[model samples]
Target: MFMDLDALSDIIVLKHVGHGLTVVTAGVDRIELAHPLTEICDLEYSGMVTYAAGGSSVEISCKVARARDEGEPSRPEDLLLTCIFTMVALDPVTRKPVAIPRLVCETPDEEYLFQAGAARSLERRTERKTSLLEVAPDDEESALIHRIWLQQLKYRDRSHPLRQPPNVLAMSRTQLATAAIMQPQYRNRHQTMIFGGYHLKQTFELAFCCAASFAHARPTFVSADPCAFRSPVPVGSVLYLTATVVYTDPAVVEDDEAQDKINKDGGDSESPALTRVHVRVDSKVREMEHGTARVTGQFHYTFTVPKDVRVLPNTYEEYMKYMDARRRVRAGAKSHRSLPVAGRDGPNLTE
Candidate 1:
């Protein structure tokens, strides 16, 4: 179910010795090869994950990615290597990923790992079918939710305790969306699609703006979900990345002493009183002519705020977003676990 990352060094050896040319593996996604062997090895897909159904026709994304030989590359002989965090399976097949590659697992445990990933992809697809932001011609549930939110505005008293006072700090949903398009140059030449890492970085940048504004300060990087590259963002497509501050620290109100101390000390580097917020980002894209945005990726982040800012959700929709964020965070905490890999960027599950 889990492995010491050091075992990958041996597995990489087995690849050259003929078990398989490529290691079909489930681990932290990184591209590592031996020296001199690195000459023609200019592919820089660090922490990129590709997940697809076993069926044919896997589409890869080519959005917001560009080739840059900026970071150090890994070699087989390197004493310590990154991206070997969690090895549930490995594939030795020699073929390249024309479409998304299916797991060519060697054992039940390996298949088990791959299956779990596939299941997650499926679950995301199902959720995307009717996300709150998605527009459908006849989506009754979505319409109902919207109507219910609107109805609350007419019936609820303005002076009620359920809503934030007019003078309280708050954030608007208006600043949450950014519109952009994917270009041909963003894709990998060989694969003709965007690298997962590139998409992730770009998405994080957008989320940072939303989180920073909502937190009223710079937020510390916590962790992100292992990318489940849901679908490809084709070249020449418009992209809409929505970053929502779903939840803000619920503590700063009750413990003014600690909040004041943190505010003064700037959230002591390791202090538990650090203001925290959960931000969720969804990647959506559509054809240049089409108006509807389909979900491409789902990412969640937890950041510790450095300010004593207050985020009051003033409306039904805003209130629901806060509550939903809290629920998801709770669910994630229940199922999350971490493995101590030697050189991991982020754990497959959580850190």
Candidate 2:
């Protein structure tokens, strides 16, 4: 008995006792158990044969790095050995395909954990030290690449089960001078351009630039956010990006004069302009079995604007107030003192 591709693909999800484990129990699709049962039994036997031959079972173990769990927020979680299934050739005696169930193990490896922790630590250090502007020149090619990525971020929907369509949310930019006013690190003569393109994960780096330019400040181009996709985007989709200052912070008003100096020096401030933009993205089912089973995806992001462009005053003020309140709350919490309780004797209690 031979199984067709669709029949072979029909895998059953089964629960295992005592391990909180789920296994792909093969042969559930068969109306008559004899053939499928034999296939499954043979699969287990094959595992035993492989173990005898190589001193280890021919089992592929994949750690579940992220999975949907009930009653938990939609966020990535640590890896766990929660699922186990064994695959082997069809029974040699019967010549039919089958899958076997293997006991899911909870053996945690300390070495793997330490290695993963070290890798994460290094990544954090890199993110803190890496300056996006330092890696690429602020040339036309760089801007073009940034523009392409911005567009991709705005338009391309990576086919994720949980995501949303792309839409225009916000946009802005920050220059070296403006950035210098906020942080002392950028005060040197070198110019740094910041371009942000946001879709979902809008907080992550969509694209950024810090570079020298030779053009005067001018509105060379502008466009609204693109349309949203009706379907989910596949993973590894090329994201296009382009950012322009939609608004700027008022604190860097003085830097406008510095921009003027660059203009007077015959250097064009137009080419290597800094920009930040917020984009929307739509999420849809890339693959589905039933018509009603769908995943809920989200699209929300914030872009960093330069400190010169005139933004909606009310919005900017609200943001500032929110930041101020948050700071105050944090500071007050740090300074808070606990009151001493008096015991029955009218004296402070001591441990």
Candidate 3:
């Protein structure tokens, strides 16, 4: 669905979402429900379909991207939406849930979200602050998204589920990408201003490419740091984007006994170990009139990778970037280690 980011931002500013609660709609389509027998998400949702099951939910997190470049990426000066979706299964008879027999979700993805949610609350309550370029993985936005997902998941049943391993960190690999985009085609659509999503989209694409190429694997889109669009790119401005992989390392640390046990079971030793890649992106818009450049926006991204992958930093710049990424990751981890909010802002809303 087409989401209005400007509208969402206004809501966030107003906190019209019932006391700091934000529910942004994403352009996410439901693929299909997990089959009751095999629990496979193999079907795509086409219109005019019938659900033989009970009520279910697909939770998605969406943010507005600027759509000024109507050439390749069409837009009517609109908010381009990016999304992360989660699906839960429901039963047809009792209108309950069909519990999928799986291990406990110790996946770094889930753990990070749950723990980071608390960590963020602690940071906000403590001394930590944030910027567009650097964000703790477990920030308020992450917490909000994760909380929605966790709430949706609670509808299902879990009994004696085993635990899955967290993602690994990719510290040895370093990646970089730079690109320049032409000005908007639909000048009338924007009238006299540039859309923020256009620049944001360029930076995000570069970051994604850098991460995906560096890993030599598909990088799942996780979370991105906030982009305020504080500065604007002028009309006829050529936006230049620089994307790089700053930090990476394993996320999980198991005890010696647990490690040995997993090793014996052919876990990380056999299966590729997962890692987290932190990608930072910055954009500078070239002003046509003054021939000067101004920083328009910056963003940070988190993606999963295999632990065996090493992103080595050869240059001093790369090394510093790596250190910076590590610092952010550590900060995020710290937030996850704090006392989580029972619900939004600390009070238990359910009561």
Candidate 4:
């Protein structure tokens, strides 16, 4: 079961399904780096079907772990990354969701996994309705917004070198973007649309750049929020990605200028200072015949940097994005606190 992800083959063949039908990721429910991979080592990967809905949708759980010696069983501590993905079969020509075979659980463990996946899926749908994007800022968020606005107003004029604090940056200044044509090589197994993994890679790279720029230090990835694919990008279409710092969790740190001076007077510090950075990437696609672009995906990434930094929203739109990212960060922290690290054992087949 441990193998290269791309080499994995389909386990189910729906009866009467069209020959050219393709499967696509409906959403990435979660992707968390449980621990860092600090050294070069052989990696093992495994995945299993956790749940299947009435029609085409199914939930899959995947894990990446360090390869163990022969005859040694995998432990939860071996896991490096854990992911949950929702996928659906689609008609190639029409790009519509297609009905597929229903999953038949053959064991009690399988049934448990099925039920757990169902509950998580339902919770995700329910949570979307009341997400930060759909609701107005609460009292505390409003106060935070006003405080950020006041800080920016006082430091708006960069013409004077001392006006802006070194630790704070305008959200607009942290944007990093890229655009590309969806080439034939990027097509998925369906051969009709660009691959979802390709899109994820693009977004992650740009988000990393945005975070690094904002923090002025190399950033280490911590996690990624649930990312939804709104539309499939057809081969030959234009894809545009924009990544920016939407939130920052500033931690106590010595002044960067003072720290640099200390390092210069003495020797470099043994370890780098670190703080959390949140970056969001928005993707849009435009076909050759269309004059406008349509949103295709949204990705949020969390990283840690070696310096204290803050992102201040200077505009209404930026404020909303900032709030959305803030809410996601808090939600992630709460979820992690409730769940056991890795699992009681290793990655659970029933998770």
Point to the candidate with the largest TM-score.
4
Cα deviation of 112, candidate 3, in Å? 22
Q: How many residue pairs clash in each candidate?
A: 7, 44, 24, 1
Prediction 1 TM-score vs. true: 0.51
lDDT-better candidate, 2 vs 4: 4
lDDT of 3 by residue, 1-351 (tens): 212332333233222112322222111221111111123222211111011122232222233322233355422223222322222333434434443223233345444443443443354445335533355444544443344234324323365233322222233434464645455652213244454334545666787788887777887664554333435565666777777777655411213453344334433466666767778887677766677787765577777766444344444455456555665566656643211212112211110
List runs of model 3 lying over 4 Å from the truth. 1-7, 10-178, 185-190, 226-230, 251-269, 337-351
RMSD of each: 11.4, 25.8, 19.2, 5.2
- Best-to-worst TM-score order: 4, 1, 3, 2
Alpha carbon deviation, residue 173, candidate 1 (Å): 4.6
lDDT of each: 0.47, 0.24, 0.43, 0.72
Write model 4 residue lDDT over 1-351, tens digit each, in one string: 111332221332222233567777777766788778899889876667667766888766676778899999876667787777677787877878888666678877667667767778787888788777677789977877776665455456666433454566778999998989999998877777887777878888899899988877899998888888898899999999999998886411124554344324321346634668999999999999977899998999999987756676778999889888888888888767221223433335522
Residue 148's lDDT within candidate 2 is 31
- Model 1 local distance difference test score: 0.47
TM-score of model 3 (CA atoms): 0.47
Candidate 2 lDDT, tens digit per residue, 33-78? Answer: 1111211211211001011012111222111222235675422222
- By summed lDDT, which 10 consecutive residues of candidate 4 come out lowest? 1-10
Error of 3 at 173 (Å): 8.6
TM-scores, all candidates, are: 0.51, 0.18, 0.47, 0.83
Q: Residue 156 in candidate 1 has what lDDT?
A: 65
